[model samples]
Target chain A: MDSLDDYQIPYGLMAEFDTPADAMHAAEQVRDAGFTRWDVHTPYPVHGMDDAMGLGNSKVGWFTFCCGLCGFFGGMLMIWYMNAYDYGIPVGGKPNFSPFASFPVAYEMTILSGAFGSLFGMLFLNKLPRLHHPLLKNMRFADVTHDKFFVVIEADDPKYEEEETRALLKKAGSKHIELVNE
Target chain B: MANHSVPSSVKIAPPPEELERPALVENNRSLGWISDTVAGVIENKTPGWWKLTFGISLLVSLGLPIGLVYLISTGVGVWGLNHPVAWGWAIVNFVWWIGIGHAGTLISAILFLLRQKWRTSINRASEAMTIFAVMCAGIFPAVHVGRIWFDWWLFPLPNANSIWPQFRSPLLWDVFAVSTYFTVSVLFWYMGLIPDLATMRDRFRKVAGKVVKPAAKMRNKLAQFLYGLFSLGWTGSNRHWRNYEKAYLLLAGLSTPLVLSVHSIVSFDFAVSQLPGWHTTIFPPYFVAGAVFGGFAMVMTLMIPLVSLYKGLDEIVTIRHLEVMSKVILVTGSIVGYAYGMEFFIAYYGGNPYELYAFKNRAFGDMNWSYWWMIGCNVLAPQFFWFKWCRTTPWFIWVVCGFVNIGMWMERFVIVVTSLHNDFMPGNWGYYSPSWVDMITYFGTFGFFMTLFLLFCRFLPLIAISEVKGVTPQADPHHPLGGAKH
Candidate 1:
């Protein structure tokens, strides 16, 4: 029993807020207080919360743009290789390969690849499909999907001091605070 | 300045002429209420009507396989395909179903880009409709090609013969366009569903804890596990949402053009051809307008009853939503009417005798009844929406939507059959009508569509719960309910 208890580590401290405004204000405090490993959780993506949390613009667009370019050129190359270079059959006296004719298909491919990029990029950035997390086991944390908002400051954060962090969260207006364990 | 200071106790009213827009979610429903209402539909016991409808639809949906088997065994001759009227109900049904899919994309993608907050409540179900409708549409072109096995040749894949698909051909372009549209729509729909699925996962977890019966508990546990699996362990983290939102916005941006291109390519199937009526520059825009017109009608057709049948849905999918959709119908329907007139003007003004004859034949030929039906339903039915009473009344909107649905179908029928029935040579002229297999298969698609939709409604969130909450006043940090000072 002592060995098992020794293996357990404190995951984070979670602070519950009644509304998004309260959560946003707390996030601003956490940001200003220089907490690096902390997160705000809410039912939906609250407007202006990004700024409050000090998050810059998301990087998902770069993946989409690069993949979209590949899709378009890949589509064009496939057509050019299959029709013009390899088989070389002409119909209706038109050219074996014309970009005009291939534009629609290539355009479709661009969108398809761009869509793939957006989804996969998001998943990659979020480190999702993890299926397990410390906060997920916390019963009170479940309300983050319903109506409640929560801010979690990880124990691993450099500036994390148990008493000082707890006091700061209390001053930030969180009525309930609990320690989550991993 | 002194006079202005004397009004401390007086109350000033808002300007009478300024009309406040109706709230997106009625009755100022709380966030918990929104989640409960939406998740409750799936978590509660299955309704009798749902079971009955699902059973009937499952049974009726058999006609698709039955008709396909018979058609495959007997051949394409089973359909009403004469020399001139070679393209028949199959093409018409394909275009009709595909067109019906457009409104879903319009709502989910286009409206999102335009920042129309009202679209949040209806976008999920409609996107589901788009996917199913595309499935129905895909069946036609795949089967219409006499050899079903050879349908794989539509792609640019390398085979033994080493021949590639004609990139210039509109028929091949359709293969790429429709396939891409379907794939993108599913991706967008699934992405949107992730957050909502997380909500269901959490709720089911709670339910599993409360249930004492082992078997019932097992079922709840299974549901929770499946939802949790799909939800990808979403924690509603703002860091995750930042990327999630950007991805959603990009998808919406991509889907907007993809949706427009899909119908345009479908229109190209006709327009690129040398056939007098088929070869026209106006085909793309006209077809797009008609697709939007028909798609909204299908949305209304599905949503009106859904709102009424499902308890608590009426508040989320409010009368304002219906009225706004009705206005879209009126606007698009009028555009379709304008296109109809423009087609005639182009035919006469272009001074092509065959084009002239085709237009005249569409109105006065043996198939004239369909043309008039198209006119009555597509052009005139939506005119009722101009009246506030018609727009506000659910039953009236449903009835008008029904006519618009029929009218849109008739419009496709007239376009496909009428123009083709008479060829360049008089000897090629012949009357075309669908065989029983065509009718049954077409009807079966409705069953298939409904079955898929009913299953979606039963298992999934009918309304986008997270998105709907995002639009609510309570979700606003500056709003009083959100704890901001006035």
Candidate 2:
């Protein structure tokens, strides 16, 4: 399958830090050192890590904005085609292409597109709905929702080497490191 | 001494400690504040009007099961219906309720964005109002179809039946817009609530005393499950807060246009049709404006009575908060009034005999009295807001807010019944008054709305305790507002 999902990161490497700052620092070094297939797992979401991890500004909003524009035009087109061209019911001399009556439909479509655009775009972009993850296989992943921080280096990263990754993570201030495989 | 260490003007002692809680506890929901006033209000005795209101709503909502059974058994004919107005009360109330949801989002989101300090007191109740009202709003469209038993048909894709619901239908559009609004609003409301609920859970644990059956495992389990599901595992760490805050900001930004879109889509129900008064470009904005106007009024009406009964009014909800809401009421009320004039001007300018006559008949015909009453309540009553005396006085604001709700409801009444009463054909023209079912159902809806809200107030953390606590200088209040300095 030629898909982002097919670009699977099968094995995981874990690093633990007590303070968020140190964890975020390690995440940045891992990313800046040119490891693309990676993720930062924390007890909770960390600030500035997206920048640290070399993630671009999310294209989800662009998807929403574009889809919403599409919706606006689609609404106008549907209404125009259905009411004016197809049915042709003329009550007043108002244009068959009435922008006024079209506004409500356009408004709804904009909302519809923006909402679904963000949601579906997020799921698709993240390659979600896989039902399970390699992270879930790690019992230590449980504490990621609580009082700890960890960063995982995926085997799929081009720079990934078990001994090298461990050494790199230890130098970046990780208090503990573990190897995880699925 | 703790309060006095600060400069005199810098530290205002919030009203007496007893006046600071956000809403009245069940035992303390009565009126009065004598030396024994706390005793009086807190004696497991409720007030007359409130008891009456709560009782009526309880009965009506209890009948909701009955209404559902009737609807399921007898089909949608459980209410009056015919060809021209196949929708009737359900659709009317759907839009009304959804419109009702806006004020809370406005208070929580818009005020949050603008950095209004006063919103803390009222936003909790306002958000509760939003959730309950949206619950009420969501009901109508589900049952409006003849066989509501198969209501899942209001979906986006092709189903097992191999017939995808028409994307072209306005009702389908409403389904998508409204469901999305409700989903996001629920997400927004719940995500904001978890920390407060955790606070409650913690407080309740200590107050439960030693050896209390392992702390009601089932109850705790449900709260934990709900909390876990929604919060996505929040720990309130500064690092977590950074992302949580960003996610919230992103959501608020998303919800802003959503609020506008949902109501306008609802208005399309009428505007798309060519039924004289029904067909117009003005309906969308007018409906959205009127929704916000009524929504704010309802928000004030509930909050004033609530914060007065709760222990912490001055700090959590200051008089300044009331003043800010009064401004909102003023702004939205003006937009509604403007919409009214636009309708008239457009009608006159167009000079289509039927459209012009419909406007004339509403203003000067049999229903002229209701039209003027609406103008008086929604428009004229809010004008009193121009005076600070009126805005600051809780009793005064309550009275005016009451008028705004009545006026907005009447506006819908005038639109629906009057327009339908006299159509193009003089022979078919007739007045339609709601029968007992109509009036009862309307009352039931109020009952339904209040019942859910009262339960929320009593059970849930009606005030956003953590959010409010987050803003207090005690919680980083000394920081410049919205952390602009950061």
Candidate 3:
């Protein structure tokens, strides 16, 4: 492979903020600036930051809802298929397909599938378990888990301009700015 | 702390003392401070007491598998189970352990959905407690199935014999209920751990800079890699948090029903039966209440010592948290007491001689000592918490909670044994007493539970670092709310 330094690969520029407010303000400015591929990172969830980033409500609930419905019916069907349709049992002289008797298992399965759906949905939507990100290459970036908050404007954003983005971040109260590598 | 100032047009801030909510975590520590406190417990040297406790627990934990192996080799006859009392201490301990597991879900999921911020400080440890308790609970049923090797018969797989689990049996419902409870609990606990693992990963990297030993440096690297892998490369990105929060809420929503249903189904194991004492409709709610009561007692039992053992946890797991938990114990304990009273009242009111005799037998028969102990421990012990001193004093509350824990176990004993030992036919009636194998297996489960918990305390973040930080006013930016512009 060619020498790494010779290649032109602009990953992004990261700006650090001392507080969540500065990060939130910077995020709003970045959002209004029409950057679609940018994000804010903080040690914990910053209330109202979702609005600051102009992100929509998460679709994870819908996934869980659908899975729960499927599980409810699926569990009931399985019980009926096994007990009533497939092999008829005359134990207790009660009907094999009683919904009252089957409700507990059905309820349990609904929760099981719903929980799995939500967890997988969240991971899927967030594209998690990536195990690597360009931002992680910078040691100081790890501070996002501690005290620091950051806003990263990806170079892939169509509106990105090296000088202008740097100036924009500085104006938004960023304490430290770095040119992150790909 | 982040900005608390608000705009003039909104409601004026009240005096600080009159604030709507008391601080969940005291001392007004920073986000980094909270992370450092939790991570330091893991990174620091193992305390001498921790070593001593873990050593004893480890030796005890070995007995669990030993007892199981012995039971399997010698057959279920090794247990005290026989004749009228076929479900001995195994089922009693199973129901007890499963019941004890409920408080974790109640704290993590139900409280999370309810927005009880105080839960964050203790939820991580309690959730670990839940997982371990369930593991102990699982061993009972696995061994209870006479031919242990053929336990797969519980599962509905395509088989040559073509036999299926009895769908109408509450025991079958338990197979599904318990497995799902374990799976969802683990997922919820792991999901909550992701951000904290990232925190741990970062802390390990920082420690690597100061370590002089090459071996220590390599260990740090390994630890960092493990944390990073489990954290799923989390960066606290807003998009990720948005989705993570939603998914967490949905899981909490799903688990609430599960917590209620699991114990109800457990109660159904008896309530569905034809026996007079076991056939009561009140068993479902009564069992759930007793479970929560026992669970909170166990949490208190675990938390009191743990909060004192680790430095800085006093501020995080404040005395007020214990007070609130005590209040819950009091409430649930009363419900259990009321259920006990109603069982007698209804038996008399209905004029059913069999039901009346069963109730009378419980309070005045051969096992009356066990029944009285259950009432004393579960019902009377928690009544002390009504006094603020008893609730506020850690040692006093701990001792009381210990009784509550013992009482809950005995309550299970009374429910399982008392109900089964006496039936309609006086000829078939018999007394049940635990054998050595039964006693050893029960004690071994404690070793198993404590061993897992001690490991959790030493390795994982005992407090949910990210969740605790999220609750503090500092994380808000505009803390009291109106100052920061959107």
Candidate 4:
């Protein structure tokens, strides 16, 4: 156990709230407290929490839109090269480079890539596929999937003071508070 | 304290009618209650009926590999395919199975995007069905190539032959369309399952009591580990929920178009061809409507049995869900019927002798029996849903859906066989029929689909626990008026 001392670090302090309103109120205070490294968790998406947390509009839509555009052009270019430029053979006596003929494949590709981009972007933004989270070590954290709400302020935040932060969370009406160890 | 009680912005009180109707999930269930109920179903012992169904399905599914071995060794000639009628039961089955997959995506992705709250209980099962049905659909086109080994030729991979897939061809487009549809559906389904799987993980952990013996404790830890692994360490953190919700909404938007495009591209397999009965503009919308119709029938067929078999599930998967799905069947079935009628009218009104003969041949031709079967099952059968009794009764709906499944299959038969059996060149035209290999392979797909479904029911949370809980008023912590009191 002594040998493990070097590996251990202070993960964060987590505070639990009973309702979305309680969590949102706490989140607003924490945001005002100017803690950049923090988050709130709830069972389902609570409306107005993002605004309370001061999160910017998600960049995922842009990623999907760009990927979809690439798919469209990439599909167009592939068809143009294969049908018109490569070994051009007219089957129904139609034009080889007919845009009408290429629309279905291109449209399908656009959607395919757009969907892939959205899913991957979401995963990346959330930093998922991280199978071990410090938060998971706490059994009560599971309630975030069911009923309870939680907020965590990371120790790495510049203004994080252990006693002061605990006092702040207590004032915010957090019923149960625990230190998460890494 | 005032801020903590109820935010001024929250709209917890729903309309007056919401009180008149039964809850989408009955008994005024709480979030904890919903999770426990769904997870309880999975942890319980395999029921005798489930085991029996699985046993029968597994036994019948063996026919698939056996049929395939015979098909590969003996070659495509074992099927009833001839020169003129080159596309036989294989293509028809492909279209039918693929069309059946559409309703799952429609319910999960399309209805979800439309924010239909009632979809929450059923979406999980239907999405799983979409993936399984696509697996069944992908088999026909692969084996239909005769040389099963060279099916990779459908892919546009660079090879020694240096031949890329023809981008202009509808068959090649199907390769892209179906593959993309499969990939996206799986991702969407799995993404939705993560939160629910986490709920299951926690539930199992809770049951693995603290003071239990070492052996029991180890079992609990193992279960927790497995669930945790599948959940990707989901702690339901607020940050994760935000991104998850955004991803879900975006995926829903993408899939709505995908469901429509997939069947339309499948339709192109017929519409792009020069065949008089086949090449028509109506095929795309017509095919899409028919696919949705058939897909809903399959959903109803699967769901009716599931809710009845599981004790607590009937409360979650309420009667309203079935009634709503039945109404969808009625609407889409009518569209399919109208398309069939329009095909005839256009065939006669178009003034082309080839088209005229094709429509005439469909009604009074060699395969006229199939045409009437299609009409009787697809058109006349579902019109019974117009009555409240037929729509609400489970057995009645199931029987009607059975007709729908049969009718849809016959519709495909009428569409494919009728046009091909008599073409412009009378000498080349020939009748199509399924040999033993064709019939066995087709029957085996049902077994394959059911086997996967039973396994899914046994292992995974069949209904989404988290999603169902999310829809309940209890999940809304701040909305005391809307949600159940703590």
Candidate 5:
């Protein structure tokens, strides 16, 4: 098995850093190097790392906005359909359907659906709940949720060159760099 | 003489006024220290105090089920509901508990939006409090309807009766507001917990590997798997964090208006009616201010004790946090005081005899003692927070917060009972008081709330570990501790 190690599949090269600054600086170098298939990992979101990585704004707000609009209209329509159209009853001598009467419920529904949109939309975008990633298997990677930070360049990146990438990571101040197995 | 002898060249600029704020996490604690300290409370063996408290709470919590069963078996008549004062302790407790829930959102959502870094230490626990308080609040109206089974009628569900809930009604609006509030709070809270849960999962895995005993290993394995499952296999990838941060911001924004609306809708439950004391245009903002005030007081009441009980939590939840919270209490408490005065001013200036009489009755009538108690507790108790001694002393803050808690309940009592006990017609007026059942049921809710909170403290991260670390100077990329050039 030891002799057959060369045949094992490579997932990516992971470079570990003790501080967010080092990982962020490495991300800037990687971004400048024009690597598209890579990510930085840390226990918390480091401030200003998005620009360092050259990533654009997150698209989550659109999901919330669209769904919130739907919820508001849906709530209004539901009230109108149930009370005014389907089972009309005269109690307070007011109009059968007034937005004023329905605004509170509609507003609440807007928030409810908007929240759902934010959570599910975020999950959808992240491609999460994968449960079985090569990164999860790496003992060194576990610190990503503790105190350490990481930068991983996928083996599938077009500019991939094993030695060259390793040298770049080493140059960027990572003391520990290892190849992750798929 | 020494000053006169000093030369102009030797003159020193008075030390630049030290304006740098206190650190959110005291003692410049490291990231690993933050995680270990927070997760340690859950990972360590249960403390003796926790066992005793949980045992007592579990015993007391049984009163809720027993009281509910008896109430259901007998009838709503078992409560202190009378003809004129139909709404009683149930309504008062509902409003009070719901109001208590508001501080969590205010801290988590409102403070987050405002970029108040100190909130990171207290947000998770307070959010849990909000969820539990809302659960307690939900129970009252559900059972108060006299027909527990028919509570489903509040929703716009299809029914054989071919009747729909009145949309114009504030009661129906309450159904939407509270249920939405609960759902959004849980979502926002769980979303924030995911990364921390991942930390717990990884830590449990590390412990599981080191442990030798089968029982210990199995426990750790179970914890690891549970935390991992809920964590959604979080790897702290920047890609995920990007989306997660955006979602969090959006949720915070959405929740701000939702929190304000919830209490406003609750106030509408009374304000929409024609009752002299109840029908005030100032109800919405007044209720919101009161809710935030009571909620912050409850947060202090719970957190001050927890900070002392848990090891190393004092560094995370520092005196500065308590003092800042006390200032918030003072501000909101003053707003409530203003509302109180404004209500009376409106009552007099409006010149309606009934309104003026209602104000007079509340201040000097049979239930005036409750009014005075409300004033003393809600209005005056937090005034002590203006003093640095009172704000910084944990025991003093705790006592004042206890007063605020009781005062808030009194405020609700004065609002619900006083307003209802005196109708326009002399014949319709009557005195209202709680029965033993009402007292037990309300007491039982405290037990239920405490039981849930204790379980949370024992099993879950009591502080937001990741958020706290993010606020620490070490987490700042440009800070020297983060490897930046000095």
Candidate 6:
């Protein structure tokens, strides 16, 4: 199913917590309980969610760095080929092949590259400019931007079972969960 | 509905006009010191140092007319121009002074866009620096060519007489670039000044009786008249700030690129040429980094003390502001150092003989002392920012900033002089130093720069009183206990 909640959860399983510590404790219990397809969102950043979620570090910065490199070289080649090689003028006895002279233009390229790289890289990797999204459609999910925290266990989880998942949620002290739909 | 929905009939009292003059703080004999002291300082007209600087600068500005008359009468032969150095002191000073203007814009526009709050107090003075510094810079190239009459040839026109300006020429590109820079800079400076001018106008209106103090009633009256002319009598309503702020953003958007291009094209003048030292790809950012480095150093030199002298502004100007500015110095200085490293690596790795020799000569050649001094001021002095003592202490920070300015100037001198004096051919190598006229004119620009800045400090609200008030805890201080101003 395209929707995350379309799957299910175990009996009385509640993803619950008052403190970050409690959240982490319940998160470990949830994971250990074979709740494989779930996500945890928090009020403030928690320290070890990546480990808890088994997620890897992001590749966004590396993409930006590559873009910056492209800019630098692009700038260098433009000035060099145009000035020194293509239409060489020997002003003040400077050699036609002066790489030293090609620098300033190239430096601008580096900045442009880095800036553009960061911008486009961020947009591309985040899959932005989508005008509409399935998640943002949910009014409850909207409140996620504010003071609320949520832990979502999908119907697709290996331990997914509707009745058991509801009981499991209740047992774990989740304050509430009204079903979110497409 | 009438009582609850319509709101209370009780008039919510308006807050006091200033921090020291708050209704709560006033009427107390002890707190009277704050307002009495501030009014006292503001009341005392421009001080001795200001008049002295103004007198000197006015005298030096007269030098421009005198020098122009001399140049116009005698022709290009009056000044020393020889075979190797085609672009002499005039161009050199233009680049140097324009480079000096860099820090002001960076402090105001770049830092403001980045949301640095402390820039409030010093940004006014630094923006004024940008205007005055750019004015001095704009003058140089105007007179550089022999026939000042035919200097318009540099413009890019598609006319029949000859042909298009060589876009290939960095000099031509510089004409496009620097003029754009000056135009955008003036616009940016003026846009920022409008809101402040309105504030001054309001203050003058409200306190017309007390205005006889700082200036003669005449100058204060002149300020009021000028503000009316410029602002069209802006009435400090929300609508005015909204429109003014929108215009400010447009100016900022225009300036960001102009700042980058102006220095980049300047770097092109050397980097496009095939001179050994000048030709390297590192030059553009290196020069920009160096330009900003020098500019901030100049800003630091003036702003540190000036902020302390102005009343109530110290709260806004704050130690944190200088500390942050010092960090920028450290970061840009490091970028310059990194550029130097890349130059060294590329020089050796590429195995170009002329390039290697040019760089080597700059460091180890006869003028090596200048080169070492450059490294000491630019590279070493900035490293001090790593220490809290260096960044936190105002006296120490000022001294180090002075060194950074010296270092940056030396960097420009080393770049211009070493590259020109010695080139690819050994026989063509020669020495160049500023003559008395060159030295005086250069110092005269400083006199001009300081003269404008000093007058700005004295006559204008040195710290933007309105803007500083906007940022203070009285405006938007983080309040855990309450929702609004305490």
Most accurate candidate by DockQ = 3
User: Per-residue alpha-carbon lDDT of model 4 for B155-205, expressed as tens digits?
Assistant: 756678666677788988888899989988998999998888887787776
Task: At residue B208, give the lDDT of candidate 4.
Answer: 66
Candidates' DockQ values? 0.59, 0.06, 0.61, 0.49, 0.55, 0.02
What TM-score would every model get versus the actual structure? 0.97, 0.68, 0.97, 0.93, 0.97, 0.65
In order, candidate lDDTs are 0.93, 0.67, 0.90, 0.86, 0.92, 0.63
User: Which 10 successive residues of model 2 chain B have the least lDDT summed?
Assistant: B29-38
Question: Candidate 2, B173: how far from true, in Å?
Answer: 1.4
Backbone clash count for every predicted candidate, in the order shown? 0, 8, 0, 2, 0, 25
Quote the positional error of residue B418 for candidate 1 in Å: 0.6
Would you list the clashing residue pairs of candidate 2? B19-B311, B19-B312, B20-B311, B20-B312, B20-B313, B21-B311, B21-B312, B473-B477
Better of 1 and 6 by TM-score: 1
TM-score of chain A of each: 0.97, 0.86, 0.96, 0.94, 0.96, 0.71
Calculate each model's fnat, 2 decimals: 0.84, 0.05, 0.75, 0.56, 0.85, 0.01
Candidate order by lDDT, decreasing, is 1, 5, 3, 4, 2, 6
Candidate 1 off by > 4 Å:
A1-6, B1-20
Instruction: Put down candidate 3 lDDT per residue, B206-301, tens digits, no spaces.
Output: 667798899988989899999989999999999999999999889999999899999998999999888888999999999999999999999999
Higher-ranked by DockQ: 4 or 5: 5
Instruction: Flag the better candidate by TM-score, 2 or 4.
Output: 4
Interface root mean square deviation of every model, in Å?
4.4, 10.5, 3.2, 3.1, 7.0, 16.9
lDDT of 1 by residue, B367-464 (tens): 99999999999999899999999999999999999999999999999988998998577988999978999989999999999999999999999999
> Where does candidate 6 stray beyond 4 Å?
A1-182, B1-43, B60-63, B66-68, B75-80, B156-164, B209-220, B477-486
Q: Which is the winner by DockQ between candidate 1 and candidate 4?
A: 1
DockQ of 4: 0.49
Over the stretch A16-49, how does candidate 3's per-residue lDDT look in tens digits? 9877877887887888888988999988888888
Task: Return the lDDT, model 1, position A89.
Answer: 72
